[model samples]
Target: MTSLSPAPLISLTWTDHVTGTEGYLVVDRLVRGVSSGGLRMREGCSLAEVAGLARGMSMKEALHFDADNPGARYIPLGGAKGGIDCDPRAPGAYGVLVRFLRAMRPYVEHVWTTGEDLGLSQDLVDRAATEAGLVSTVQAAYPLLDDETGARRRLAEAFAVTVDGIGLDELVGGCGVAESALAAMDRAGVPHGGARVSLQGFGTMGGATARFLSRAGLTVVAVADVEGTIGNPAGLDVEALLAARDAHGTVDRGALRHGDRELPADAWLAADAEVLVPAAVSYAVNTVNQAAIKARWVVEAANMPVLPEAESLLAGRGVTVLPDVVVNSGTNAWWWWTLFGDIGPDAEEAFAHTRRSMRALTDRVLERAAADGCTPRTAAHALVADRLPVMAERFGWYR
Candidate 1:
């Protein structure tokens, strides 16, 4: 069922002259001479981790391919990812980022189209890209686009659009995650009004997911950030805490009410809830900590958040894990949809597309899981296995 190679198509490591920090780029695949992924900056980011993320992106893109649908303008591209081994909060981190981008400029200009990932923001990446003398982070895609100017304009407008003070770009991905959770709950005969959820990380992805799930009538019982976990049995005021977040996505502890309890950093793993979302970092849930989870479902809102061994353990315990390739793919798909004219700059249209696509995909994965008696991750990989050959037949294996 494993379709992708263990080794990536191309791998490069760069050492920054300013900080001597390492950066990595792994192109998992390429379609039409272009590949898409995000640039993540974090401490201890290894080439192996970047390679895993790159492969995950390949699956994420392949999962969305629909050739028979005439209205589907978004043709999923191949996967690539970049990472830097430095803390974004550390001194001279920006310098390292600029230098890293400068070194990766050739790929960005030719083959790789990237945006922000963990420990970095799109705005920060855009600024760094500008300083690196690059036209845009996604400029490589311009050549493949039919009307690059119009697509660029539409994307910019979409990025500028906001709903209730949250950017449209940020909400679409979370909307997909929330819908996947809802679809699973519906399949399991659980009511949204009664489901209690706990999540780690309050950044753009996690915060937006909390907003949508809260609006959908789910009680967000706990949320964790760098400092610690904030929990309330009665459900914390999601809006108030959202308003109190800093640029780095950490919620201001001073904003907590009397009912909100600041717990230990790992408290979210053991919180009394029906659903758990590890939206923070890679390998957040390992075999040892998997025993602490009592939730019926663990939805990965972060890439590679759950290790394979941990996932196997959770599956043995009757806990279903919705894989990251399926759960967190909305934002990437949304970008392509808008750029390729499948969707527009309007928030409502974007949300509708994301919901429809994510719900259908989730249902398909879950149904296959049930029929095959396998994990959702296995089912998802099987689905990808069935499609990659077709895409390769049409587009060819090598770009």
Candidate 2:
């Protein structure tokens, strides 16, 4: 008799058109016991991309569960992602957003709990959940806002500890790009002391990156959001920019005095800078824009921020591109450790282990890439693939 194989997790897609724009909800992998993911809103988001992200989340969780902590005894939580292909910048965007959320209400009630993602805010999520009456007992059991803030703080703290343990300084808050850029610069020997930095996207990641880079002695020459680009060759004050930034991450126009110009959204890519970090959406650095990038190094803090073709193009131009999987895995791994607590009684020690592991992984990948003249992305994949089988065998996943 043949042994029964486990059922493959289900992926669901739903689409709706409202206010003359289309929206999609893609559920990637649903662990039968617990499930979670986020919603992404942008003009070009597709079901395929959302589905792929969900699957990645699943793999992320699986790896965390299996290797990070062995005795957590926690069942798998399925992963899901939703995307809406509506420009959040347009008029009536909020209305379409509400409709999109309403359409996915049933899923939110039963098997999924969605949080903020690209172009989506926590306020919007709370509004949608409240409107749909899908707020869970867990959410209702505590002081709503306090619970969210507390959890986020704890997660952020854990992330900081993990990074510090790895021998890297704590990430200067901004987006993932700031952290990734720091890592890339450290590896590439780019001097931060007098480097001029330009950033596209001022959201949590971008804004944080600017502030951190500035504090670290890098001169932030330009910053751009969906609204426009602001520049000052003498270096913009990150603190002033942060104060002027609105909730959507756009800097207030009235607060600038310098070489600021109202340029196209993509203009930030061409700005003169020693380092350019894209902490915005995926595919921002595609074929068309690849030729325009002026930075000596491009560090992607967002998932798949550069298309493969763009990466090839940049590589040919002698640009060093730091892959997201390695750069941001530190944050992902920390979250998993927090959720499962598999590191034994000493959370500090466990976090230290995570940091050491992350730094070691980065060093190994960089060393291999240099030795073989390969891209960091390729080296990362090769490293992971080689180690995974051994990990599986040790975990008893195979006899």
Candidate 3:
């Protein structure tokens, strides 16, 4: 029996308040010659928390690549994550971020490729380039980010204000959330064509999810942004709302109509819907509001949207909460499919492959979870954990 625990290859910590922050760079595994993950900055972030996130990235990449295949021509990259405990909006935050990045350049240059996570944006990337003189390397690394393009471009454009020549491509990440949500709905015997769905958080993840799910014919009855939650029980115009969402995914209150009601924070959770998507941040479904959650399924579009303890309670209540490790892996799968897979001249064809691969991956994970009688999160982790020995043997990690 294989136990699912985060066995990180290395966990490095630094406490340099002189640089105005401290963080951890946890490299969970190395598949071939490389590893990849995100870099986030938020107050109270810890080494252990980043280590856990790195493990999730490891599971995400392994499952997306069909690690169990053993002989597949996978990308051979592992999972790594870095983050600092600080506010990104503070007066000296930019200086602190640049100093931190300069200090970590040796580790990030090759061993661990990182991207934006949580509070840190492309501004950090842009400014870090000017301050640390690593714009060329960052330019190459950022385009590899398949999902969340809008956010990245915004960050790169933030570079235009003070710097020159750095560019970013457009990307988004919620297709996997929609696909996995529908896959889970399919397994749970729910009708997606007319399923009532509500999303909390209207950022790139939630916005893209609303777009895809709505296009698939699901009724998005409610959506919440930073300002507040707004809904129309019949359905909300997802595309219009997506276009209307601001830089930070704040939807305009004035744009909502058709008997729309501005509900309280808990309204999205309690919406009379079949699915609830928490695409904002971790611990969205905690003990206090977990009880009010009426949806039959909870799809985590954001990383760790549902905490472990709250998840147990939801399971007891019969709410099937799909884990981010499986549900929100569209971003990783897109990276594997686009930047990594064999490409032809057709852009649409490549995108089609991405969609098919994502759907298949989600379906397989859901199928395994059902068969194993474990949560999808646990099942996905098991799938990755089981392949570690083979990955080591193939990639020569231990040698």
Candidate 4:
């Protein structure tokens, strides 16, 4: 194990509002590194959750370094997350959001750069950035779209043209939880074509995932946003849904009615499908709704979408649950590696490289899990744990 320095300490502070509610800003494991993870915001976000995500970023950086030719040394990159506690669904929340951003401007500028996440839109991010007088570059001018088609087009073409020597055909599996789910399905002998799918979120990751699966011949039957859940067993119009979705990740209610059923807030989980993607928020599949899940396979598109008890329950019911860490790590990895601008030709190439790396990593984890008779989650964690100590040692943190 490579050991160098101790993991840096992180701190968080909560500020109370006049309504007796509180919001938090958390810093986790800063390496005095060149870049820091983007800030994510959502309701009911906790310090522990932010810390966990930050730690994941650290591990991701370490793993990327390990994979470098001749073994790249660790660079000083850090992780941080912040969020407000109020419901973004409420009226005049924009003003509240502005206030929150302004309040944290000083600290944010000093240590972190905020980015879009659940309950936060790119438009919102730009507004916040503008208000804080932060520089707005790197495709920040575009309107928010759930599908992220532009981003994906860049990512796909780049991977096919730049990274994979065999060209686009060899760029079969990309990355993220979506790739992990695909890997699992391949392992279980489940065919991809005509498979029913229902997605709970329609954000950048969720929308891109839906498109990827659809292109691969899966039938996306339902998609849910914060506005409402829309289902059509005959297959949803992914393009139409994308067109109707607003900046807040909510779809317009006035859109086409095609024997569509409007389900309750959590009804997306109950949609009959071969695969269910919980891509919206954390703990969406908690104890309260564990039994309601009917999908044969649940792929976590969001961080910690499934609770421990819920996961165990799903396992007992013969439902496979793919872990979020390795799945979501694709985008996270791309973002981090691109910090140096030396990763590839453009952002798209960087993202494609990230996908390839993630696919290979997921495949190895799945193979090891099957060979060792353990869960994919267990095997992935074991792989990371085994490597982290070595990385720490190589950096002289351990003696």
How close is every model to the real structure, measured as TM-score? 0.98, 0.73, 0.84, 0.78
How much is 396 displaced in model 1, in angstroms? 2.3
Ranking of all candidate structures by their TM-score, best first: 1, 3, 4, 2
How do the residues 90-187 of candidate 2 rate in per-residue lDDT, one tens digit apiece?
A: 78767776777777776666656566667866566667666656653123212212345555444445434433122111232242345456556778
Clashing pairs in 3: 32-76, 148-172, 149-171
* CA displacement after TM-score superposition, residue 265 of candidate 2 (Å): 3.5
Writing each residue's lDDT as its tens digit, candidate 1 over 287-393 gives: 99999999999999999999999999999999999999999999999999999989889999999999999999999999999999999999999999988877777
Location of the lowest summed lDDT over 10 successive residues in candidate 2:
164-173
Stretches of candidate 1 exceeding 4 Å from the true structure? 1-3, 397-399
Q: Evaluated with lDDT, which candidate comes out highest? A: 1
- Predictions in order: lDDT: 0.92, 0.62, 0.70, 0.62
Which residue segments of model 2 deviate by more than 4 Å? 1-9, 17-21, 30-36, 55-79, 89-113, 136-176, 259-264, 328-361, 383-399
Given candidate 1, what's the lDDT at residue 336?
Answer: 94
**Candidate 1: RMSD to truth:** 1.3
Give candidate 4 regions above 4 Å deviation.
Answer: 1-8, 16-21, 32-35, 59-65, 71-78, 89-114, 133-175, 342-351, 394-399
lDDT per residue as tens, model 4, 1-399: 232224435455556453444555655543332224445666677777766666655555544554455532224244456666667766755666666666666655555544656676655766876775655312221122233454435434444452322222212223355666777777788899978899988866677677667766788888888767888898877767666766555778677577777777777888889899988888888877989888888887787789888888888898877777667766555543433333533535554565567667778777877788877677766776666655554443211
Off by over 4 Å in 3: 1-7, 15-19, 67-74, 122-127, 135-172, 344-347
Candidate 2, residue 135: the lDDT equals 58
lDDT of 4 at 364: 79
lDDT of 3 by residue, 184-270 (tens): 777678777879999998866787788778977899998887677888988998877866776567888777776888888668988
Among these predicted structures, which one has the highest TM-score? Answer: 1
